[model samples]
Target: MKIINVHSASLPALLLPLIFSPALFAADEQTIIVTAAPQTLSELDTPAAVSVVDGEEMRHAAPRVNLSESLGAVPGLQVQNRQNYAQDLQLSIRGFGARSTFGVRGLRLYVDGIPATMPDGQGQTSNIDINSVESIDVLRGPFSALYGNSSGGVINVNTQTGQQPGTIEASSYYGSFGSWRYGLKASGAVGDGTQAGDVDYTVSTSRFSTHGYRDRSGAQKNLANAKLGVRIDDASKLTLLFNSVDIKADDAGGLTESEWRDNPQQSPRAEQYHTRKTIKQTQAGLRYDRQLTENDDLSMMLYAGERETTQYQSIPRAPQLNPTHAGGVIELTRHYQGIDTRWTHRGELLVPVTFTTGLDYENMSEQRKGYENFVMNGSTPEYGQKGDLRRNERNLMWNLDPYLQTQWQLTDKLSLDAGVRYSSVWFDSNDRYITPENGNDSGDANYHKWLPAGSLKYAITDAWNVYLSAGRGFETPTINELSYRSDGKSGLNFDLKPSTNDTVEIGSKTRIGNGLLSVALFQTNTDNEIVTDASSGGRTSYKNAGKTRRQGAELSLDQRFAENWRAKAAWTYLDATYRTNVCDDSNCNGNRMPGIARNMGFASLGYEPESGWYAGGDIRYLSDIMANDENTAKAPSWTVVGLNTGYKFNISKVNIDVFGRVDNLFDREYVGSVIVNESNGRYYEPAPGRNYGVGLNVGWTFE
Candidate 1:
C-alpha cells in the first residue's frame, strides 16, 4: 500500500494535463475508462477489453439502422437483420446465444445506466434514440462480470448530457420503399452551478415508417426520451430518465430455401408475424460522492426502472390441419412486464486498494395467452380461438456482487489487477396449462456461482500496451425456458443445470507511427449447456448438454493515410465447435457449433467525413456456417456491399447534410439466418435478397 501511494502522487505531478484534459489523449490510445466501470471515460488499468463508438459515426450510419447493425464493425460479433423491421435485431457474441422468439435471449443491453434488456435477459432497444447518444461502450468476454445477468457481455449506451451552451437539433429523412423519418433533440443547463447546485435537462423524439421491400413486413415506429440532471454539490449528482416506444409491424415468417431464392422480398403468411408492439421504459437514479478525507472518498448510487411490452407473431397452419387452417389463420401471442433495481457503492479503501459492493434485484414475468378452442382460421387468428392457453410466471432473481481490485505499481511500466465477486441467484415459477395432452406443475429453482478475475498489464513503450486475464460466468434458465409446456412434456422439470463457462484471454493494443491496431485471443470452456430436443413425433423438451469449448481471435485496424482519407477494417476467426457426444449414436460424434460462422470481416476506405464531399462503401464477408447442432448441411458463404455518400452544409446554428445509401449493391440473394430442422419436418428460410435505398437527411442546431 505504501508503495502504491508513493507512485500515485509522483505520477500525477508529471501527468497533470494528460489526466485532466481530453484533447491531449491521442485517438490511437486505447483502454479509455467508462462510467459503466464507474461514469467517466477513464483509462482501464486492467486487462478488460472495451470498445467505444463515437457519436459522429453513429449519426452518419443512421441509415436508421438497428443498434446491432452498427456494431458489426466490432470484431468477433454478428448482428443479423431480419428485414422484417419488427422481429429483427438478433445479436451474437462469440456464439453465446441463439434465437429471440419471445424476447432477447442472452446478451445484456443498457442505455444510460438503465436496463435495456428486461430481467429475463430479453433485451429491448426500440427506444434507443441514438440521436442523443454521446457514446456506446461495449465490454466483451467474462470481464463483463461487473454487470449482473448476461455477464455474457455488456453494452452500455451513454446519452448526451446537457451542456452549458444550449442546443436544439432536428432532422428529417426520406428513402426508398416508402420510407420516411423525422427527429428532434434539445439539451442545455437550465441553471448555472452556484455554491449550492446546478440544474440541467434533455428531451428528444423520433418517428419513422417504411413500406418495406417485402409484403406484410411494413412497419411504423415512434420513440421519445427525456432526462434531467441535478448537481447537489461539487462531487454529487442525480439523474432521472424516461423513454417510450411504439411499433406497428408486419411479421414475415421463415421461408423455404427455394421460395427465398424466387422472391427474397416477398412476405410469407402475412397474418402471422405481423402485429403491433409497444414498449415503455421509466428510470430514476441518484449518485452521491463525498470526500471523507484528503486521500479517501466515497461514491454511492441507487437506481430503479420498469419496462412493459406487448408483442405477437403468427405461425403457418399445419399443411392440412383443417380446411380452415389451410387458409392460414393460426398464430402465437406473447406479452412481457419487468422491473429492475440496484444499489452500489465504491470506496477508496485505504488509498491504493479500491473496493466496490452492490446488491441488485430484477423481476420479470411474461404471460402467454393462446386460444385453442377457437377455430384457428379466418384472417385474424385471435378472432376465432375461443379458449385461452393461459400461462403466468413469476421469478425472484437477485445477486450480490462485491469486488476488490488493486494496481500494484511495481515500476513505471508494469501494474497488477485482481478482484473476486460472490454471485448468487434464486428462481421460482408458478405455471399452469390446461390441455388434454400434458398435465401442469409448479416448482421452485435456485442456483449459485463464484466468479473471480485477475489481470496484468505491462507498458512496453509509450505507444504499446499488452495484458492478460481470465474470469468465470454463469447463466440461469429464463422463465420461458423453465416454464414452457409443449404438447409432449409432463410439466416443467427441475433437473436443468445452470450453464457455466470460464474464459481466458490475452490482448495487445498498439500505435505504430500513424496507424492503430488491436488483437485479442480468447478461449472458453463451457459446461452443462442448455439444449432443446424434439426427436419424438409430437413433443419437445429441454435438457442439459454435457460440455463444449469456444476459441477465437479478433483483429482490428484504424488508419489515417492522407489529409482527407481514412480507413477501418476488422476480422474475426472462430474455431468454435462442440465436443463430440460419447453417448449419442448415428454419428453425433463431431459437429461444428450450430449457427456459427468460421470467419467474418468488414472493410471500408474513403474520404473522411469532414470533407465537403465524402463517399465510401462497406464490403462484408461471412464464411460458410453449420446449419444445426448436428453439423449437417454447410450453408454457403456470402459477400455483400453497401455504398454511402453525402455532402455537408451549415447555416448559422442549423446544420444540414444530405446523404444516400444503396444496400446489397449487387442485388445478390442470401439469408442472414438458417436453421435446419434435423427432424426434417421444418424448412430453412434464407435471408432477404439485395435491395437498394436512397435517403436524404436535413438537420439543424439551435441555441
Candidate 2:
C-alpha cells in the first residue's frame, strides 16, 4: 500500500546482509532416501518438507548443468536460468508458479514414476538426463495436496537403477560462451542375483552445445535415456522407460530496460523475424509391481508421449493482420497418454495402518498449427519464413483422478496421514481454419476438484520430530492458458477457472551431532489468483485475481565436520502479499507478489575424502524481485558463487574422474530471471558473468 509505506523502514536494512548468509542441503546426507513420499521415507521421516539431491553430488558438483545446478541448496525452490534455451527453466515453489512466462507451473514433475507433469499443469525439464541421475527428491508442504493437480511441490526424478557389472561411460565437458558437453553411458546386470527371473539395464546419451551468452542465443541439444528392469516371479515387477529429445535454439528475446543497459549480449529481435526454436520429443514408460500378500501391494503405470514444436516469433505485420492474432509461425503437435493404478495395504486396523488406493488417467491431443512468420511475395507480404495458412486448431485434453490414502501408527512416536483426490479436467477445441479471417471460435471447458490432505507426526526424542499439515490444491488453465483471449476474443477462454489452494504447515526435525535439522512454517490461501492479463509476441494472457496470500519460513541444515568436511544450509522467508483488491491498470493492493524472492539463502561446503582429491563451494542468496503487479519494478538483489575441484583415479581397471568448475565466482552481474507482467518492459533476465567448466570421466567395468 503506497509502495509499502515508503519501503517499510528499509526492511531491516535489506535483511542485514542475510545476517551472515549462504544455503542448499547435504548436511552429512541425513539418511536421504526419498520417493517424494508415496512411501519409503527418510528425509528424516517425510511428513512433507522433504529434500534430497545427490546424484553423485550432482554429477561432480557445479555444472552437470541446469536444475539450476543442484537446486541451489533448495529451501522453497526458485530455480532460474532464463539464459533462455528458448525459454525453459524458471521454476517456482512457494509463490506457486511465479507468473510463469514459460513452462513449469506450480511444480509436480517426476521421472521414474513417469509424468514429467502435464495433466494440464504444464511442466518441462528438457528431457532430464543428468547423466542417468539417481536422486533428486524435493517434496514440500501439505503432503503436496496428495498430488492431484499442480501440487505446487513434488519433484521426483530418480534414475539410475541397474545393479552391478556393466559400466561403459564416457563424458566430456568444456564451457564458457561456446559451451560443449558430450556423454555416453551404459549400465549393468541382465540376470544373476540369485535370479528367480531377472533383468536390468540403463542407457544414456547426450550432446549439448551452446555458443550463447546472449546474441542470437545459440543452442543445440540431443538427449536419450532408457531404463528397463524385469523380475516377474517371486511377487512380480516390471519397468521400462524411454526418453528422447532434440532441440535447436536461438531466441534471445526479452530486453528493454534500455535493452538491458545497452547490449546485454544484444539480440534486438535477431535482425527482425528470425527468433527461433525447434524441438522434438518422444517418451515411453510402463511400470508394474506386485507383492499381493503379507500386507498386500500392487501398482501399474503406462505412459506414452510425443511432442513436436516449432516456434518463431517477432510478430508484426500489423499483428499478422489481426484476423484474431495467434500466429507467428508456431506449428505444434502433441499426443500424450497416461494411466496409473495403485493399491497398497497393511494390516492391523486398530492401531497400525497403511492403505492407499488410486486411479488416474490422462490424455492430451493437439495439432495446432499457424503460419505466417513471413514469405509470401506474390500477393505481396514477406518478412521471415513460413507464411500463409494462418491458424488451424484441434485440441483436446483430459484428466480423471481418484485417490485415497492413509497411514497411521498411533503409538511409539505417533503418526497419522490421510489423503483424498478427485480431480477432473477436460477441454476441447476444433477450429481447423474458419473462413473470413478466423471466427467460428470453437470452445469447451470443464474442471472439477475435490482435493484433500492431512498429516500429523510426533516423536519427542530418539532424534526428535514434529509435524502438522493440511492441503487442498488445484490449478488448471494451461492449454496455453486456455489458448488466448484477453479482450481479443476468438476462442477457448471458456471463462477460465480452476485455482484453489488452502495449505497449512508446521514442522521440525532434528538429529544434531553429525547434523540434520529442518524447520518449516507455512500458510497459503488462494482462490482464483492467476493475474497477468496480457503480454505479447510470445503470447500470454490470463486474469482472475481475488484473494491470495502466502506465508513462509524454512530453514535446513546438514553438517558433518570431521570426516572430510560437509556442510549445507538453507533459508527462506516469504510473505507473498495481495490479500484481496486487484484493481487493474497497476493498482496491486498490498503489493509484493510478483516473481517472488523475498529473502533466500543457501550455502555449501564439501571436501571429499576416502578418495584422492576433492573440493566444493557454493553460495546463493536472492532478496529482490517484484517486476510487476504494481510493485512497479525491481529485480536487483543477487549473490552467487561456486567452485569445484576433483580427481579420483584408477588405471589398471580403467576408471577416472577429473573435474573443474567456477561459476559466477566474483564476476557477479545479476538479474538471473524475471518477466512477470512484461508486456514489453522486458523485465530483466541477465545472468552470466564468470563461467568456466572442464570435465572428463571415463569408466569401464564389465563382469
Candidate 3:
C-alpha cells in the first residue's frame, strides 16, 4: 500500500473503504460533533481541518503540565514550552504566531463557551485546569476567521459535567527536577433525573510545584475550577463556571548560543537581578440556553474577571537612565468583562438548513505602572529591588462585534457554509504620571473590520469527502505592542494599523482499514504584517512590514490495527516567508519567518487490553528553525522519544490508577523554543534532556 511510504503524496486517495470497513465502523460508531463549527456538524461532515483529543486519554499517560504533551500529535499546530512559566507556552498554527515571545497570539481560545483571548487578540493558557477538562477541540483552516480577530485557529476546551452518583477523587504525582502535583475533585448530580429540575456540579483544586531543570526557573502554582448546571425546564438550561489561578515563578531568561553550549543548566543573569513574577487571576462565567421551539434555540453567555500581575526584570540600572524607556519593574491590575448572545433556527426547504446570529461585546480596563528594578541610594541604583515609580498609566480597550452564519445542505451529499462578522475595537490611554523626566503621552486608537468566510463540502461516498474554503482575518496591534515606539518617543503608537490576511484551502479525508486519514493544502497572504523592529532589556517595539505569504500542507492518520493496538501519526510542512523587501537591522527580502520550523512530524503507538495494563510510546521530530528575520542564526533539528505505562483496577466500591512516564528518553539536547529577534542575541531556550514522572489517582463513589 502507498501508506508504506512515509511521504506518499497520493496516500489520501489510496486509503478508501479500507479505513472505514464494516469491522472498523463498530469500533468507531460514535458521532463526534464539534461546537467551534457553527453548524454543529459531525467531524466527517465539517469542511475544515479539525482534531479532538479525549481528555481522559491525556490524563492517563501525559504529564498534564503542558498542553503540548497531549496535542503534539495534531498536524499544523505547534506547541512548545519555553521552560519559563511566566512567559506561558509558545503556540502557533501554520506559522501565524511564531514571532511572539510571550503568551499566545493569532489564535482564539475558549473554555466552556467563554473567551480566553482578550479583545486585543492576546491570550494566556496558564489558567487551564487539565484535571477538569473533558475534551479539547482544535479547528484550523480558512474558516477560522469566523471567530473574529486573530483567528489563525481555534482551541475550544470543554470541562466535564457531573453525572450519576457522587464521587470524590484525589490525585498526586512526582517527577524529575523536584516537580510535584496534587489535586482533589468532587462531582455528582444534586437531583435524581437528567431532565428538568435537576442540578449537577463539579469542583476541583490543584497545586503544582517544580524546581525546574534550569537554574532560577522554579515555580509554584495553585488553581481552582468549578462548574454548576441547572435544568430550569425541559427547554432551558443554565451553567455557571468559575476558575482561579495564582502563580509565582522565577524567570530563567533566554541564553545566547555560547552560553547554552557552555552550560544549559546555568542561568545567564537571573540570580544577580532576582527576576521573578507573581500573578493572580479569578474569572466567572454564566451561560443560558433555551429551546424556544422545536426548530429554534437561543443561547447567551456573560463573563467577568480580574487579573493582577507584578514582574521584576533583570534590566540593568543604566538602561533606566533613558527617560523615554519603560521601567524594569511592571505592575498591572486589569478588570475585564464580556457578554455574548446567539440565536439558531433550523428549517427545511427541499433540504436541511440552519441559521445562526450572534452579538458580542467585551471590555478591559487596566491600571498599569512601571518602577525601577533596583533600590536607589545617593543617586546610585541597586539592581533586583523595586524602586520609585518611573511610569504610570490607565489603559482601556473594548470591542463590539455582530455576526451571522448559515449552513445549507443542498443535496444528500453536498453542503455549503457561510458567515460574516463586523468587529469594532476602541482603545484609550491616559498618562497619569507626568513628571519633569517624562513627557505627556496620552493617545487613543480605533480599528474596525468586516470579515467574511465560506466553505463547500462534497461527500464523494459514505467514507470519503472533499472540501474547499476561504476567509478573511485581521489582527490588531496589542496594547503591549503599541506601548513603545522604535524612535524612542513616548506614548502608544496610534499610527500602527491592523494586519489583514486572506486564506484559501482545499482538503480531503478518507477512511482506510480501521483508520481515518486527512490531507490539506492551504495558502495565506497577509498585508501590513507586524514585525519586531527593536527589542532590548525586556522591552520591544513593533513596525509594519510590506507583506508576507504562507503556504503549507498537513497530513494526519489514526489507525486501529487490533482490539488492543492502535497507531497515530501526523506531519506538516509550512513555507512561511516575507513577500516583500523588509529591513530591520539587516538587508532586504525573501527571508524565512523566524521561530517556526518548516517541517514537523509525530508518531505514536499504544496498547490497552480489556483488563490489566496499558502502554504507549511516541516520537516527535522537527526541522531547523530560523532565529531572526535576518536568518543569521538557526536552531538545529532534533528528535525525541517518550514512553508510558499504567495499571487500573477496582476494589469494592473504589477505583485506583497508577501510572509512570518518561520524556525525552534518549536524553537528546535541543532548544525547545526561541526568543525571536532578541536584541542581545539571547535567543535559545533549552529543553530538559530527560525526565520521569509517576502518578496515583484514587476515586470512591458515595450513594
Which one is best on TM-score? 3
**Per-residue lDDT for 599 in model 1?**
94
Order the candidate numbers by TM-score, best to worst.
3, 1, 2
Report the Cα RMSD per candidate: 7.6, 24.1, 7.6
Please provide the root mean square deviation of candidate 3 (C-alpha atoms, Å). Answer: 7.6
Q: State the local distance difference test value for candidate 3.
A: 0.80
Give the CA lDDT, 0 to 100, for residue 249 in model 3. 93
Cα error, residue 251 of model 1, in Å, equals 1.8
- Among all windows of 10 consecutive residues in model 1, the one with the lowest summed lDDT is 1-10
TM-score of each: 0.84, 0.34, 0.94
Better of 1 and 3 by TM-score: 3
Lowest lDDT sum, 10 consecutive residues, model 3, at 1-10
Rank the models by lDDT, top first: 3, 2, 1
lDDT of 3 by residue, 1-703 (tens): 0001001011111111111111111122212224521222245656788887878877876667779888987899989989998789999999877778888988888877677888888888988899988888787877667777777788878788888799999999999999999999999997763489899898999999999889999999999999998989878888899999999999998889999989988886788788888999999998887778877777788899999999888789887778876779999999999988777766876777766677778899989999989987788777778887888999898888777776677887888777777777777888988868777788777777777777788889998989998888888888888788878776777666788888999999998888889999999999988877766666777888879998999999988887889899999999999988777556647899888899999999999764579999999998999988888988889999999999988888888889899999999999999888888998889999989999998999987
Count of clashes, each model = 14, 8, 5
Alpha carbon lDDT of each predicted model: 0.57, 0.76, 0.80
Name the lDDT value of residue 408 in candidate 2. Answer: 72
Query: What is the lDDT, from 0 to 100, of the residue 228 in candidate 2?
Result: 80
Who wins the lDDT comparison? 3
Candidate 1 C-alpha lDDT tens digits along 1-703: 0000000011111111111112212243323233432235532332556666776677783555467546767787766665666555656677766534324556777776556665545575676787777777766665654444455666677887776678776676676778778888878886674434687778988898988766766788887878777777765565667777767676555555566667766655444334434444455554444444443444444555555544443433342233211122222222322332222222334343232333344454444333232243555434222333333333444433333333344456765555444545555544444345333455666565556665677888877889887777666666556543333333464566677778889988888557778888999877776655432111124556678788999888877787777788989898876665722445554466656788989897767656378887888888887655666555678898888888877777656677777777887677776543324422233554455555555554445
